[model samples]
Target: MKKIFYVFSVFVLFSLVSCVTADNNSKKSADNSSKNAAIENILNRKSVRQYSDKKVEQEKIDTILKCAMAAPSGMNKQPWEILVVTDKEKLEKIAEIAPNASYSKNSQLAIIVCGDKNISERFWEQDCCAVTENILLAVEALELGAVWCMAYPSDERVAGIRSLFNLPENVIPLNIIPIGYPLTQEQPKQKYNADKVHVNNW
Candidate 1:
């Protein structure tokens, strides 16, 4: 009886150590993968103004939108309305509406980030901005390029887009993003400034 009890104890200890080692390895692998993906997505992100003639796949576009929706909102209100535009004529008109976004004319797709004031009241703009950043990051992750074109706060641009889309009065256009395959490569430059950092207060 004593010999049998000793053997059982040894078996239990060995099994516990094995399970712990396996769990630690699995966690370490997951952590490394997450860290690498985040670094790659962030470091390679850059604005590409010029694009090739190639069309963006629908799957990638859907993934980008999914990522946009994954962003957190204030109080989880999620007061965002996304408008996807792919019509060639409309793309040309968008370029006309925002002169700085002339490169949009060549993009395969354009995403217009909008905020519905009726939903979150005051945090609509802030929530929309978070979604926009997620879209940009997803674009880079999918090996695509995009440029953000401001549309809000500009009466002319906002009115033009609203009129073109027949948007409701409560919906405000925030920005337009033109996405496509890059015509040229852009390297990410480090713009970090240590002086801008404040420990507790600015």
Candidate 2:
């Protein structure tokens, strides 16, 4: 009787340990799946400069704008506006402002993302930055090429864009994004550096 009882107790303990181990394995698998999805999306993103001259569809533009608006804003004050430019003549004029941005002239569309300074000065840049990133990612997901060009902080450039678009005085230009179908394939960038990541104490 004593032997039987001891054997039964050991069996119960082994079963409990197995159950715990299985649970941990299951959680790890779920975590890994989530991590893989995020990594895949980030790895696939690339900054495309060369583009085809084909016009971007209006529905596609709307979808990209919708994605941009979904970005989180500071204090929930979404104070950003987007100006879409499709006219070839206007794009040429705008391209002249950035000497290095001759590629803008060939893009199918340009989006001038602006921030309303009247809403919250503390988060104006942050809000606009979030929206710009969203636009870039959305364009990439849609198999389009987009190049981000800085506009804010440059008084002359901001003024030029504002005057060109007849924007309100309170609206501030943040970035100019040129979007279109990619003419050249984007190569993966090898930018990872293990030295950049620090442990908990670092």
Candidate 3:
């Protein structure tokens, strides 16, 4: 009877370990799939200037904004602020100020990335840039269309945006992103250059 009891205990232990190993392998497979999905999304991203008239859902806009905030910042300053503009008049006005954003008129909405001067003024531009890239990446992931329009480093453009948005003196607009459904199918450019990579030392 004692021998039988010991055998039963060993069987149970082996079963538990097998189940644990299977669970761990399943988790690893899931993680790898998720990682590949992200890479695929990044590789497929393209700058879309023409957009269909279809209006972007607020839920998707919220998701894009959430991803923008998730961008990494220097010293965790997180100094970025996002403005979602859906008004037609305002969109037109934006195009007037920055010709690079002329596509904004056709897009259902525009996202204005801003940075606060108080949150490490020296690093605000870099942080805001990261946020803009995040917005673009998220747009691609969501199968939406968008393009990054220049707003900073141009005094005239900055002044025009400031007046249009009534921005405070401390807040600086970084860029304008016009987003909607693509009107035409576009392909991502092959920009990777193997020669640029240097291992260990240049």
Q: What TM-score does prediction 1 earn?
A: 0.87
TM-scores vs. true structure, each candidate: 0.87, 0.79, 0.89
Give the alpha carbon lDDT tens digit for every residue of 37-93 in model 3.
Answer: 999999999999999989999899999999999988999989887889999999999
Error of 1 at 137 (Å): 0.4
Predicted model with the maximum lDDT? 3
- Candidate 1 residue spans exceeding 4 A from truth: 1-23
Relative to the true structure, how large is the alpha-carbon lDDT of every model?
0.93, 0.87, 0.94
Task: Give the TM-score ranking, best first.
Answer: 3, 1, 2
Higher-TM-score candidate among 2 and 3? 3
Worst 10 residues of 3 by lDDT: 165-174
- In candidate 2, stretches whose alpha carbon ends up further than 4 angstroms from where it belongs are 1-38
**Candidate 2 lDDT by residue in tens digits, 1-202:** 9999999999999999999999999999999988986677567778788889788998899999999999999889999988999988888878887544566788989998999989977898999899998898888878898888988888888888888889999999898888999999997688899999999968
RMSD of each: 2.9, 5.9, 2.3
